[model samples]
Target chain A: MIMQTIDLEADGLRALNATLHAQKDDTNQTSWEVVNAKGSHAIAVGLDAPIEVTVRGSTGYYCGGMNKQATINVQGSAGPGVGENMMSGTIVVEGDASQYAGATGHGGLLVVKGNASSRCGISMKGIDIVVHGNIGHMSAFMAQSGNLVVCGDAGDALGDSLYEARIFVRGEVKSLGADCIEKEMRPEHLEILRDLLERAGADAKPEEFRRYGSARQLYNFDVDNAGAY
Target chain B: MCGIVGLFLKDKSLEPKLGEMLTEMLVTMTDRGPDSAGIAVYGADAAGQGKLTVQSDDAERDFASLAEDLGTAIDAKVSLYQKDTHAVLVAPADKLDQMRQALRELRGNVRVMSAGDTIEIYKEVGLPKDVAARFEISKMGGSHGIGHTRMATESAVTTMGAHPFSTGPDQCLVHNGSLSNHNSLRRKLRREGIRIETENDTEVGAAYLTWKMQHGSTLGQALESSLEDLDGFFTFVVGTKDGFGVVRDPIACKPAVMAETDQYVAFGTEYRALANLPGIETARVWEPEPATVYFWNH
Candidate 1:
């Protein structure tokens, strides 16, 4: 594996993304390192190749957005919208994530080793997110389809107006949003949790977590359920 | 989308560099808000004197002998330090209210930017770089400060519309998000005798805190109540005589990143503003939670 180090400060964000986008499956530069990220926006966005990119420092908005077939690793914290609309990729944050992490992602695995801010996995679709620490309010809000696993506490109104998303939380939830309630964890969920925990490097037992999902009553417009709307 | 940057120095060694540090932080967020810029610096307080930072559209005519003229009117000794379109008048602390009254009568066009023992505010309608350069804010020294770059959503792009609205002595606030109920709140605060200047939403927020503090509430308590009373999205960074505070609305969609070292506590709308701070690599960086108040005092 070849490693290429690009100074984000000197090379600029456009050049860095262009270089990363130039890589093909057979490209020798399989691993790329971005230094001096310095909280700039839109780093490593819209990549189609199956290459691994590592960001050394913190980032600004929309890092690794619209990712496809790329494994991006942020050694530091990420700003809003990390791994947004990702399709078949893995993005790992060694530090915390700002709001809306993995929002509207289609298919991917996003691992946040530290705490995640509000709206984590919001409007998510088919993405699997594993958070090792606490998550802020309104996580998985209006989530269409996904698996959100939290190893620690969740903030207020978790999973409001959810849709077919499986949420497994090992710690306390401050409050649940409308149409969301606790569900019984079965054998398949435990197996999925175990596999995700192993892959995300989390140190928690699968059985310790509880499952949550939509009650599905508000799917259709009913006058009796008007208050929940 | 406005941008706010605040620095509260815990270490005295960083005092002289406060303006330089805040200037860099503020200018980095110029793209966030480019209509106007402002800064509030809390410098060293004199033993028995207060400084009033005043701005005038016609600085050359209005600020010429206004200090000497106001001193005679208020029966006190006053000294003036002029910076571009603004001037800082140092007078007796007790005579500040008299000075305020006298200045209003003396020059109808001059506006008091701020009045307090140590706090001096300078804001203007321009880009952050030009505004900071006009006031030479980078050359000023202080213990703590807050700066803002405005995008001008709520009100017109004018000098008064720029942020760092100081409704109380030694108190200033800069906001990132818009307030929905500021017009009504402005009327209420005006009825309660709080001097709110502009139609800008942030001025109402500043006046709201000033009113709360005047009603025997601490700055922390005032901010806590603001979460309940103030309607709309806001990420407010406030500065007092000896304190700095940060608070966001319940549905905090606006961005706020904070970094704390043993030396200082810093706030920025984005991490890029704080990226150049000293010891930031090892600083405890995090986002201020929604509906949470984080405050530090000297």
Candidate 2:
């Protein structure tokens, strides 16, 4: 696989991303190096082919938004919506990430080696997010499906209006949101957590973390749940 | 959405580079807001003297010979320095109120942005880089400063509506979210004798903090009180005579990042705003928790 180097400082964000989007599936280019990111927004979006892209510096909003099959790596921090609505592939951030790191993602692996700010995984569908550091408030809000693993503390309202998503936290949870409750970490859950931890290169043991999910009481409409609404 | 950037130098050796570093941080957030921009700088203050930063739409006509006229009217020594649409008038500290009153009666078109011993504010309706260049923000030196770029969701785009609203003598605030109850709050604050100039919701937030602090609450306490009093999503970066403080609403909706190093403490709506700081690579960066007030003082 030949690697292509795209310098954002020289080529600009739109041109570089446009070139990546234009590549054919059978094209010889399979890897890309993005130099001097310097906090540019929408660096890579809507790629369907299996390619590897490495960003050399910090990025602004929506670094890998709606990614399909590209493995994106940020050597430094990222702004909001790191992998928003991603369908498949992997995104790894070596430094901290801002709000809504993996918002509404469907099927992908998003890993943040440092802290993720507020609403880290809001409305997640089927994505797998692993944060090695703390996460801010209202993370995983109204999540429909997916897995979020936080190795550090989570701020207020961890999972408001949660649905079928599974949350694993290794540190303290300030508060849980409505309909989200702490549940037992069963043997099969530990096995999945261990795999996620290993895949994300997190050092924490799976057994040390706790699990949280929807209470299922709000899943069906009932007169008794009207007060919660 | 709006963008805010603040820098408070812990090391005086980095003072000379404050404006340049802050300008870079502010310009990086141009995409977040494009309507208007403003900045407040805390420079060296002479004892017994205070500064009044004012802006006029017609700077040429309003600022010409204004210092001479103000000195005669208020019976105090006044020195004026003009930069683009803004001017800083230095006068005796004891005569500060009299000078403000005289200016208001003499020039109805000039609005006082701030009056304090150390602070000066410059703002205009334009892009952040253009506004910064118009005021020559990079050429000035200060110990600390704050900047804001507005997208104008809740108010009109006017010069007086720009951010870094200075409702207190030595204090200002730049906010990134809207206040749901600003109309009622504005009326209430005005009923209490708090002067608010613009229809901008952010100005009401600044005025609320000033009113709280004037009633003897410390800056941190006033910020703490705002978490309960101010309604709606907000991330506020406030500047005082010798301090810089940050606070987010209980829900923590609007984004805010803080970085602290041996040389300086910086605040931004996002981390990219802090990327160009002097020692940011080694700085301790974190998101300010919801309803928490973080402040640093000289």
Q: Each candidate: what lDDT?
A: 0.94, 0.91
Please write out the lDDT profile of model 1 over residues B69-157, one tens digit for every residue: 99999999999999999999999999999999999899989999999999999999999999999999999889999999999889999
**TM-score per candidate, chains pooled:** 0.99, 0.96
lDDT of 2 by residue, B123-233 (tens): 999999999999999988889999999999888999989989985889899999999999999999999999888788998998898899889998789889998888998
DockQ of each: 0.89, 0.52
Lowest-scoring 10 consecutive residues by lDDT in candidate 2 chain B?
Answer: B274-283
Every model: Cα RMSD to truth: 1.0, 1.8
- Fraction of true interface contacts that also occur in model 1: 0.79
Ten contiguous residues with the weakest lDDT in model 2 chain A:
A22-31
The runs of at least 3 residues in candidate 1 whose Cα sits more than 4 Å from the true structure, single-residue gaps closed, are none
The count of residue-pair clashes in candidate 2 stands at 0
